[model samples]
Every structure is written in C-alpha cells, then in structure tokens.
Target: MKKLLLDLCSKLEGRGIHEIIDRLKLYYRYLITVLFYKPFIGEMGKKTVIYSPIRFTGLKFIYLGAKVTIFDGARIEVVDRYGNQRFSPCLKIGEGTSINQNCHITCAEEIVIGMNVLITANVTITDIIHPYDDINVPISRQPLITKKVYIGDETCIYQNAVILPGAKIGKHCIIGANSVVNIQVPDYSVVVGNPARIVRQYNQMLQSWEKIYQ
Candidate 1:
C-alpha cells in the first residue's frame, strides 16, 4: 500500500507536470503559427493537433493506440486516386513499441503486429502484390493483392527492413537492418540479408522441439 501511494504521488507530481509542460509547448507552437501564418488559416478557431514546422506531409488516416507517435519526416500514407486507401484500418500496433521516422507501412490486408515491436527508420511493411500479366494496364489497375503479415511480440526490425506479404515473424526475432523477408521466420531467430536467412537460433535449456534450430 505504501508503494502504491508513492507511485500515485509520483504520477500526480511528475507525470502531471510533464503533461502540462508538453501542452505548453504545443500551445506555444500554435501561437507562433497563428501569428506568422494567420493569412494561411483564415480564422480557423484553434488547431488541436500540431503540424511540423517543416512541410512534412503524410499523416492522413487511421492512427490507433493512444501512445502512438509518428516522428519528424515519418510517412503514413493511406489514400490515393485509386480509392480511399483501405489500408490504415488494416494495421494494428501493440504497446510499448515505436515505428521510427521515414518508415512506410502499407497494407491491403490485416497486419497484426505484436507488443514491443521496434521498427526502425525506412522499414516498409506491405501486404499487396500487383499482377504483371498485362503491360497495357496501369499499375493502379492491377489486381488487389492480399496476404496477412503477423509480427510476434518483442520483435526488433531494423532500418530499411522490408517485410513482404504473408511473412509470419515469430516472437523475439531480430531482423537485421536492410533485410528483405519474403517468407515466414520462426521464433527467437536472427535473420539477415535479402531473402533473409537465419544466422542464429535461440537456445532453450529445456530441450523443447519448438526451441531447437530448424
């Protein structure tokens, strides 16, 4: 009970103050934009979500998970002339993880990503594949591709990683930066390079079949 009280007091004192400070910063940003760029807004009452000082255009659709943050220059494009992107709603992110700046995650099918999944800069997650049977038709006119991609809990994906359609990555897997995965990766494995190969398999002292290197 004493620990709980201490925790509550900490939240009330420190966390509350930090939130107030963040809001102050946001308010200052709004004030500067209003004063300098008043001609652009034309008397819009007030801005709720703040935009970047630089013109980094990409946050448009479906951001879930209240703790989610898209960094400076990070791109999350979910719509186009083809149709209202049916992709943003297809992506799900778990708790305590971050997708860094310049990452592009495009989905046409469901993508269930697990908790503590660290996705670094320039990581691309796509579930669509286009048909190349006919060159006469535009790429946009190609067939809608679908294959669900599931990344298990505690997985770490590095910069420039490309997770293609239908790839099921298991828990605690470490995918090296700039790796291109086109197949399923087993749990607790380390994969690297294009069409990634497993360089290491996790050891289990219990001698379980599920833990052995495949």
Candidate 2:
C-alpha cells in the first residue's frame, strides 16, 4: 500500500496535480473578483469576470469596462511615471473585451483598449519604454519614456504579440502572432511580422481585402 501511494504521488507531482488545483480554483473566480479586485480598480463595469491568481498592481489607475473577462496569470499594472500619483487614467479597457492568460500590460502614461477587443495569451502591451541614451547612467536608473498606446474597437491581437509605445491600432484590425506593432494600423487591416506591416486592407468600394505588397 505504501509503495502504491508513493507511485501515485510521484505521478501526480509531474504537472498533473498543479493543473487540477488550478482548475478547481477557477470555480471561485467570481467571489475572488468581487472581494479582492473590484474595490481597488479605477473603474469596473457590470458583469466583469476576472480569473484569479492574476498579478495586479496600481489598481487605482486601471479601468475595466462591462463584460470584460481577464483570464488567469495576467500581469497588469498602471505605474505612476515618477512614482508619484500625478497621472490619472493610465489604463482603460473598454466593454466586452477578453484578455487571455499570461498577458502583461504595464502603463505609465495611457493605454486605451477599445470595445470588443480580443487579446490572446502571452501578449505584452506597454506604454512606457526604458531610456538608455545616457552612457553615464545605468539603463535601469535612467528616466523612462512614456507614450500612449491606443487599440481601437474590434481589434484582435494574437499570441506573443508586442504592442509597443505610440501604437494606434484602428478598429476591425488583426495583428498576427509574435508581431511587433509600433505604428498606426488602419481600420479593417491585417498586420503581420516583426515591425508589423499591414499586409491586407479592406476596400470599402470592392467590399474585399486588397493585398498590399511593399
């Protein structure tokens, strides 16, 4: 009996037990969202479901809209630029948006996520960039640069994508996996690749996407 129990324990130790515990914890998500998360946020609209075990900070500057669902392991922070509470509305997520697991979003200035946006797992969205121009000062000690990142309504950002500072993604746009977006994306466009470029754009007159080559 002892050997049998030890063997079972050894098998369960290999990721299976951890996954079971995580699944079990999901049942209490609503309770955790209301009791632990709601009060600290800048704004939280109705019926917002946030999966637990999320790493959250600077909640006073973060706003989440109605029916927004944030999955497990998301790290979200609204950092004060100077470590002072001078900035208001650092992050804003619009209604009906779903943010998948393990996404990291840190904002010092402003990050506006518009309505009905879908952000896949492991995406990184940041409005602040570390300054490294000065040779004398360490990069970590240098002052950071802040810009606004705007993701428009109905946009879909795929897994492992990075939305850098000053990116303005328009409505109905699709950002492909592992892409880096640093510029403005037009409405109804499909953007892909590193330093993401618009590969296809919808033509209203033709009612179809026109392939773009450059």
Which candidate tops lDDT?
2
In Å, residue 107's CA in model 2 sits off its true spot by 0.2
Best by TM-score: 2
Off-target runs (Cα >4 Å) in candidate 2 are 1-27, 81-86
lDDT of prediction 1: 0.66
- For model 2, residues 64-141, the per-residue Cα lDDT tens digits are 999899998999977775543355547999999999999999888999999999999999999888889999988877
Show the lowest summed lDDT stretch of 10 residues, model 1: 41-50
RMSD of each: 8.9, 8.5
Clashing pairs in 2: none
List lDDT for all candidates, in order: 0.66, 0.87
What local lDDT score does residue 125 receive in model 1, on the 0 to 100 scale? 84
lDDT of 2 at 26: 51
